[model samples]
Target chain A: MKILVCISNVPDTTTKIVIGADDKNINTAGIQWIINPWDELALTRALELKDAGKISEVVVANVGTAITEATLRKSLATGADRAIRVNTEPADAWTVASNLSEVVKNEPFDIILCGIESSDHNGSSVGGLLAGMLDLNFISSVSGLDIENEKLTVQREIDGEKEILETQGPVLLVIQKGIAIVPRIPSMRGIMQARTKPLQIVEATSSESMTETVQVTLPPEKGKCKMIDAENAGEVIRLLREEAKVL
Target chain B: MNILIYTETREGSFKKQGFELISYAKALSGMTGGEVISLAIGEIFDEELKKAADYGASRIIALEADQLPDNRNLSKLLIQWIKQANAQVILFADNNTGKAIAPFVAAGLKAGIATGITGLPEKTDPFIVTRKIYSGKALAKIQVKSHYKILLLAANTFGIKNDPVVPVIERHNIEAEYFESPNKIISTEKQTGKILLGEAEIVVSAGRGMKSPDNWGSIEELAQILGAATACSRPVSDEGWRPHGEHVGQTGKVINPNIYFAFGISGAIQHVAGISGSKVIVAVNKDHEAPIFNVADYGIVGDVNQVLPKMIEAARKIKTE
Candidate 1:
């Protein structure tokens, strides 16, 4: 079995996000980037399957500009057999999925995995759009997965319930954090090996973006917190109802 | 112009977010001078259908089915209805199910799609909307230049107001073909007799400061008294002290409750991102300098072990009064 894991390069979660001077994008100065946390989890799972011999190879794919190659190299170092970088600045989820669909049509893989949503945009649309474009069965919010003899079983969350689902081969999954909670770190040996591995660059075929970013702004600053004495705990409830009017 | 809203149902009743979507659609229709039409599929109740009318649906379309199919199947069914109604704009709740299917439907219609939207369109001429990006750390105003548009409204961003109006009900007996999906539901497990965390107005959450899972009893009791949902920080869930469903953070479920009470939790940037959209935030932590205090509307510098019991007692007393 061959697996394709879609990866995204996003700003570190702890980075202080500052809107650019133009107010159309984020400030890039002195900002650290990392593999999208959820996608890291998905990649870790794919590597585990490869280690178990369930998968013959793991191919990591990303849709972004040239700068994203650094992140793809990190994924390769983390254990992907090879990496494919679709050269494009992802304007929207539709554009990203369209480019990915072009790659999926060329690469034959038994399973396609992606983070349920990118931590940056949180659009949660690409995986579904890709599945739609390719006419493949898709599952979202997957928490558990198992494969046996080309058959797959998945556990997905719905509202307040967990649904255990069974499927056949060649499936797409928008995975949440369950298969592997902790992400894998690149070993020294793996880093050396990744430099010799294939880092293929494909020009984006889809040029149309359905949505355009008009501006970016921070949320309005909340008012100062009213500090209450711990001794008078009852006042907290009163304030919540009267002053805050939320209770 | 005709606007279509997908009103999703669990079991036979509409979810609370469904009404919120209807309320939002009504406002959008008012702006565009369009008609609001609701489409529901599966085993639906008349009372639920009436609720949609009460909210502001001008017309309701129902498709009866024995089971709710997967997202791919549902999207196929929706495309047929969308074409039949000739809807210009489509809306869905930004929940698990909506996130799964809305994109598929949008792709099929060749429509521009936006999810996690925080506000109404600033301009509808070219159709521009605002949504949170970088997890609530920043908001982006997006313009969709397409013939058709799809949007998923973020939870708690819009208030649901009842504009009670009778709606015309139309039953469509259409034979929809379902794809041969590799996915099959084998079993389901539900958290019985508890308000769903996603829809709760008030949420009480805890972190590692609570010490152990044994200490969660007081948190649950307080949540019960206030008719609120119980949530946890990522560390608490990672430690297996709480179910993953109750986890609220950047990597977990993004919540937008009216009031979010953080007990014994240091505010990490990831956790703050999830609750930034909340209306009122209250933090109770022993460390007064905790980062959570930066975004909180109310702060109590005390230990959770001591403060929680007192707060719970005060809440119980107020309820009895």
Candidate 2:
């Protein structure tokens, strides 16, 4: 079965967040962007499945303006069979999901893979939202997915148990960690080939965004870590009880 | 206006997050002048279903189902009652189950939503909610323009309260095959009786300073003493000193415990991304300049083997006093 892995381009995880002048977004100056770490893992897993002959094709898709093409090219270089970019600035998870729905429905892919949450917005909703819009089965927090002997099984982390789930086709799995050990790097040969790979751009249907950011602010500045003498560990406990009150 | 909260029960009992939603629901109700009506869809018990009343639910709607449908089907089912109540606002716990269903429900209702909301709505004039975003380093104040709104409260953020109210319980029956799906549960590996790291209010995590996997007993003992969960850094898990499930970092599980005790860990930015949501962080490391100390609210300059036993004994003695 063909797989469509939905990826998000997000600021690097270590980027120090500085709110922009508009108070609604981050300062884009000198911000490094990459395929979101989790989605990178998803693309890695899909390519692995394709390599194993269990999957027919691996297509990577993202919803963002042209700025997202670099991340999509990185996906192609890492061995996605094709790349699709939905042209628009995603306002919210619903808008991203709606645009991705158009791309998924246009393809014959049976499975869609999404990162559990993007490190940037961290909404953890786009996968399920798209599943609802497309009337496909939804599973979240999936740590493992395999297609063995033409049957699909998924490992989902529930409250305290790991549920092994078996399903037919046409499912969207919100991938958590453990799907791929280490994300694949683009080989020199693959990078050269990626230039000629199809980078399809689709106009966004521009569904109404369900939410909008009013303002973004950093947390209140706090005091530095209070150091205590090693010999006076007991006093630290007292401070926890009386001062921090977290004990 | 009415607020509809989707609550869940496990083994016929409510988990801490269940009441947390109640706490959030109560706070949301107070802010918006909305009554808190809870909806639970599962094998709810007669006595267990009434627990929400103690937490100030005005009325409880229980949908008893032997076999719960998948998240998408459950969304369709919930859309029924969500509209029936004409709820202006909806609240859900931002966990595995809630994340799976809440988004679909929002789509069904065409409601504006904010998941993993760390606190109550900042404003109702334009329907704004504040949530942790971008690796917990920033807060995004989101404005939901839709007439209906959905908010999923994060675990351990909203404090559950004891507000007594005699709630009316309305029971409904749902069939096992309510929706068509082709998914089956194969097996469940249950980590019974152990505190899960995700929901853990207190977490005791260690790094390579322990030196080997053999020293892990102390970490588990310390976690047991504090009724906390045990976690490790990515390197420890990568080295197979601990299971991947116990690893917390940018790649592994991200945790937001109330108290996070880091023993011997020189905090990497990836590790900080995971625990950055924590309210209070305590670090015990020999290196005074370790990056872990930068984020830690409290720190001790000491070796893990020596400081760990002392902290355990002190905590044991202090708890009794």
Candidate 3:
């Protein structure tokens, strides 16, 4: 079986997000970018499946500016067999999903995996949008996934319990945090091999769509940090009611 | 004026959080002197619609359609809904589903969006809504200057209260377009835990100091006994000891429960951002200078391995009493 992992280039979680002076874009100055954390899970799981000889090739796909090539290369270093870069300025989730869907139409993979949400925007809309656009069976927040004989078993976290699901292959799986293995670093040999690996860059099939960002402002300031001096649990309750008004 | 609320359901049953969305919509409706109308798509739940009245909904709308299973199509359907009802504002349950579709609905309606909102809109010239930004590190007062407004509220942000009067169900037809791409309905699987983090009243999260993945068993046991959910710090997940889904950090899931207990966590800024909304935060760590103590309602500076067992025993005793 062949697997495709959709990745996103986003700011690191530790970055201090700031709106630019124009208030229409994120301030990219001094901020480090990484492959989105959730996407790491997808890449990691793909590597694990490859190690188990479950699949032949792991294709890493991303939609973003040319700078995103670095992100695709990083995924290649981690474990992806090949990389596909759809060169475009990443706009809204819809635009990205449309580009991915168009590229995916040319290639028919048995399973498609992606992160549930991106770190920079926190939109959490792309996977669902792509599934809707492609008209494929899709599941979000999948914590566990196992594939055998073209049949896939997935575990999703619901409100109060987990629900086990079964579906056929060629389905889209939007990975949540707990679903997959942690990423592994590339060895010296592997890193050298990645240099020779196929890293194809293609222009986005979709046309440029206009998405207007009105403004981005900082959140309001919080009140002075309130501390509760408590000797016991009962005192905690008192502070909650009297001081915090939270209980 | 009309106010619309998006309700969530699972396995033909309505989630309790859906009612909280109703309460929030009702509050907004009261401010506008409008009636609160709900839109419940997906699996059917007849009895759950009856509970919306007590929470402040004047009318309940049920779209008993299987085609509207996912949020993408659901948001498209709601577009015609807002036009039909002429809804001023739409309220959504701020879970995975709600968050997925809200931005789409906002974009479609050309409305401003505010997510992770904790409360209703404060009456100012341009309506101001309060939400947590920077992962609960700060509160953001957003002034949405749009003809139609869309708000997705955080889960557990509102406390559920029982109302004396039952709400009236006014069935309304939803304008829906079928998903032509033959998306099949497959099976869903459950996670390995006694209680879900969103629904749990209490939560006990551990950090890197637990040392090994094997040590999680004790945390799970205590959580099982207390009917609590188990959570972890980002490093624990980064170190491969726990799943990333169990992580609580700035980029991870934010949980707000009645009681949140932390063990072996150093309370880094990113980790603390996720739990700042918890009602009562309790910290247990060996470091007296840990930042978690700054926000914890109760702090116990000691070795968590030695303290957790005894605390669990004491908690069990209290419960039996």
Candidate 4:
């Protein structure tokens, strides 16, 4: 079986988030980028499948500008067999789905995996959108997965319940948090071999799919934390009802 | 022109988020001077559709067919209904199904959409909407700059407000077409827990400091006493100490509640993003300077093992008193 993992390059969680001067876009200046934390799960799980001898190769794919290649290379270090860059500045979910659909038109795999959502956008749309575009079976916000023979069973995290689903191969999944295993770091030899692996870059075609960054602005800083005095939990509840009206 | 809100369903009844979507749509309709039309697809519910009136949905468009189960086909049906209704704005709850179909519906309609929106659009001239970005560390104001707009609301962003003038629920027909391949649901496994996060008023979360899964019982006890839900840091979930659904972080569920208590959690931005919506945050970690305390309302620097049992005992005593 062959596996495909979609990867994203995003600002590290520790970075102080800043919008551009226009107030509608992320300020990329002076920020260190890393592989999106969730996508690491996708990559690591793929590697685990390979280690278990369930799959042959794991290819990491990205939809973004040239700068994202560095993150793709990092994915290779983590354990991907090769990398594919759908050379497009991923504007929105639809655009990324279109670019991925184009890349997938040529390369077929038994399973496709992606983080539940992009760290930056936190949309959680890609896996299902890509599945829709590819017309394949899909599950969102999955917490566990087990594959056997030609079928796959997954545990999904819904609003308040856990759902176990069974489906055939060639399925797509949006890997959610708390599920699966933590991503593994690449060994020294693995990193060295990654340099020799093939990296393909292709430009995206224009279509109805389009996304534009208008402006980005930070939310107002939270007000000072209000300390509810001891023996006044009722006071806290009253304040919530009267002042904040949050209750 | 009208506004279309997708009232998502499971089994048969309308989910709470569906009402949330209608509430938002009602607000948007009021702002846009448009009528609010809600669409309920699947084993259809007239009672659920009538409830939309309480939130100001003037019309309910429903498509009852097997295709409603397939999100791909659902998207197509939604697009058709949107075109038929001549909708200007579309609202959806940012749940799994909504997240899956909102972008596709927007794409099919040739419109621009904004997800993770916390509130109604501040300004419609340029379609500027506020969204929680960087895990609630900051907020970004986005402008769609499109004629037709789409918005997917984040959970717990708006509280349910019952309108005095309930909407008159009207039903309309939605034609559903079948797809070549349909995804089937074999079964569902519900997470065994005291309360669901979305419904919980308070949450007590544990981290690696709990030491092992065996130690989770104390946290569960505290949650039970408080009538709250139990959550964990990403590590605990990764280590199989807790179910993934209970993981709260950048990669986990984004939760907003009245109070949040952290036990042995060192605040990481990923974790912070998921729980930042809590009104009152209290952190109990040995590290005095753990980031969790940065935003916490009260900080107690101590070992979780020592602090947890005492806290649970104290809570129980308070309840008895």
Candidate 5:
């Protein structure tokens, strides 16, 4: 089996997002980038499938500029057999999906995996859009996955209920967290080997973006927290009912 | 112009977000001079359809089917409706079902799409919408460049309004193409009678500071007393102290409850992202400097074990009085 995992580089979870002076983009200076946490889990699961001999190869794909290659190499060092970088800064979910569809059309892969949504944009559109473009089966927010005899059994959460689904191969799954609890760390030897691994850079086919970021602004600062004495916990309830009016 | 609002239903009842979307669409129609049209798929009752009208739908379309089609098939159905209705704008609740199908529908229509939208369009001429980005840390004003626009509204962002206008209901029997899903839901498990965390007006959440799974009894009791849903931080869920369904964070469910109470949670960025939409936040933790206090409207530096019981008692006393 050949599995394609789509990854995105996003700001670290703890990074304080500062709107750039242009008012349409984030301030990139001093910002630490990492593989989107959800995508890292997806990549980890794909590698586990490969390790179990259920998949022959795992290829990591990203749609970004040259700077994204560094993150793709880290994915390689973590165990992806090869990496594909579509040379374009992803403008939106539709653009990313369009570019990925172009790549998937040229590659022979049985399964495509992606994080449910990119942490930065939080747009959970790419996987579903890609599946629609390819006319393939699509599952979103998958929490569990198992493959046997080319059939896939997936688990996903919906409205506080869990649904276990079964589907055949050639499917795209938008994985949520818990597919794998721990992400793999690249070893020294693995990092050395990743340098020898193939990193293919391809031009993005679609330059059109459906949505444009008109402005970026931080949320309004919350009011000062009213600190009540710990001994008077009941006062919190009274304040919630009388003052906040949210009880 | 026409605006299409996809109304979601469960067990023959309209979901709360359905009414919220209708209310939002009605307001949008005021700005665009568009008709508010709501589409409901699967078997639905007339009364449930009437709820959309009461909320503000000008017209309602009901598509009856025995079993609900999967997202792939549902998107195809929506595309057909969009073309037939000549819909310029489409709206959906940013729930599991909507998140799964809206993207496919947008791809099919080649429409500009925005998900997790928090407010109304900043501008309608070129169609600009505001959505939370960076996991609710910042807001982005986005311009839709396509002729057709799709939006998924975050839950509780738009308040529901009922004008009780009588709407024209159109019933159509259309045979939708169904895909053979390889996956079947073998079973579903949920805590009966408990409000779902996503839909709850008030939520009481815990974190690793609660120490052990056994201590959850008091937390659950507190939630029960307040008539609120229960949630936990990522570490609490990861450690098996709570079900993953109850996890609220960047990786977990994003909630917009009216009031959110966090106990023993040290407000990690990811966790804060999930609850940032709440209108009121209260945090109780032993650490005075826990990051949760930064976003909280109210804070109590105390042991959750002591604070929770007192709060629960107070809530119960207030209820009985």
Candidate 6:
């Protein structure tokens, strides 16, 4: 069974997001792009499964323009067998999921992995939308996944509980953290192989989005933090009770 | 116009989220000139079904949760109800369940979708709604081109308003063969807390600055005095110092409590993203330059050992006052 990891190229987590002068999108100038933290972890887990011989292939796919290839190259360097980039600017979750569904159809993969949400947009919808478009079974918030003797068992968080579920057939998992300990760093040999590895660019199935971003702006500025002296530390409780009224 | 809200219940009873969703839908109805219709799936007790109307639900419908085995069936059932009620807008709580299911419903309806909606539409003419982007770092105004709109709301973002209305409640049964699924559940383990972290009005969280798990007792003592929930950074939970259920961050649960207390946490953007929704934040960290202070409303530079004890002592005085 082949596994496909849906990846998104997003700004590094540390970047302080600012609206560009365009006023409708985030400023991309001098923004360092990286594989979304969750998606990178997803790709890492896929490779782990492949290394364990539980899956035959691990493919990293994305929906973005040519500039996205840099992040895809990083995925390739991290041990993804190949990479597929659908040519388009990933505008919204609807467009991204729709276009990626077409790619998944053309290249059959038994298990598909997606992050809970991208770091930049935090839409948290692509995997579900993609599952609907393909009419596939989707499991969300899957923190643990194991396949043994051709049987798949999943541990999912629901409300305040952890529920164990067993499932089979083609499955799409929207995974959060804990599926993998940490993202894999590229090895020297893997980095060299990534230079010549297959990175396929395909036309997007659709460019339309159901939603349009009309304006982008920063959140309201917060008040300066009041510094309380260490000797007066207990005063905070009085302030929280009288001023903030939270206690 | 008709608005649909999928109201969630816990253990056969309505919770804070259900009331919040109903109240929000009612507010939306005023703008859209629509009637609010609430849909309760699963096994909600009969009495709780009636209170949904107290928060402004004009009508309520109950569907057996077992009939719809998975999210796919749940989405299909929602689609069926959307058409039946002629609902142009569907609302869902942006918790774990909503995170998993709302996108599928949007796909079926071919509607524009927005998650973590913070406020009402700035204007209804173009159907624009505002939500947090970049995990609460920024805001985006989304224009829904499609007539059908699916919105996932973070509970408590919209305050619950009590505008009581008489509701028509009905139980609708699904066909036996709506879906034949293969997934089987094995077991479930629920870790109940003194206060459900998501619903807590105040939260007290700590990170590596605590130095050791043994120091967590002070954090809990403060929380007990304040009637707040105890939470920890991801690394604390990952290290087995706390259960994963107590984890609060981008990878864990995101909450919008009335107030949040951070002790010794450095406030990485990921951790800050989760707590930024709180009404107020107070940080106590030894590092003066810790990033958590950037967003905190108040800051204290002191060691946890010294500061935490003072905090606990002061908090114990709240009841006496």
Would candidate 3 be rated incorrect, acceptable, medium or high by CAPRI criteria?
incorrect
Tens-digit per-residue lDDT, A64-123, candidate 2: 999999899899999998899999999999999989988877875788999988988888
lDDT of 5: 0.88
* lDDT per residue as tens, model 5, B126-180: 8899999988989999999999999999988888887667889999886744644
**Clash number for candidate 6:** 0
In order of appearance, the predictions have TM-scores of 0.98, 0.96, 0.77, 0.86, 0.97, 0.96
Q: Indicate whether candidate 2 or candidate 5 has the larger lDDT.
A: 5
Give me the TM-scores for chain A across all models, comma-separated: 0.97, 0.97, 0.92, 0.91, 0.97, 0.96
lDDT of each: 0.88, 0.86, 0.73, 0.75, 0.88, 0.86
Model 5 C-alpha lDDT per residue in residues A25-136, reported as the tens digit of each score: 9999998889998899999999888888888999999999998888999999999999999999888998899999999999968889989888899888988889888988
List of clashing residue pairs for candidate 2: none
With candidate 6 superimposed using the best TM-score fit, by how many Å does residue A191's alpha carbon deviate from the native?
Answer: 0.7
Descending-TM-score candidate ranking: 1, 5, 2, 6, 4, 3
Alpha carbon lDDT at B207, candidate 6:
94
* Per-residue lDDT over A154-184 for candidate 1, one digit per residue giving the tens place of the 0 to 100 score: 8897656888999876889999887787899
TM-score of chain B, per candidate?
A: 0.96, 0.94, 0.91, 0.87, 0.95, 0.93
The true-structure Cα RMSD of candidate 5 reads 1.5
lDDT of 3 by residue, A95-167 (tens): 7887988878989888899797776655565776676667666767777777777667777765435667677
1 or 2, which is superior by lDDT?
1
How far is each candidate from the true structure, as Cα RMSD in Å? 1.3, 1.7, 5.2, 3.8, 1.5, 1.8
Best by the DockQ measure = 1
Lowest summed lDDT over 10 consecutive residues: which window, candidate 6 chain B? B64-73
Off by over 4 Å in 5: B179-192
Docking class of 2: medium
Candidate 4 TM-score, C-alpha based: 0.86
lDDT (10s digit) by residue, model 2, range B185-296 = 8998877788878789999999998888899898898788889999999889878798778888776676778899998899988788788889999999998889998899
Please name the candidate that would achieve the greatest lDDT relative to the true structure: 5
Error of 4 at A195 (Å): 1.4
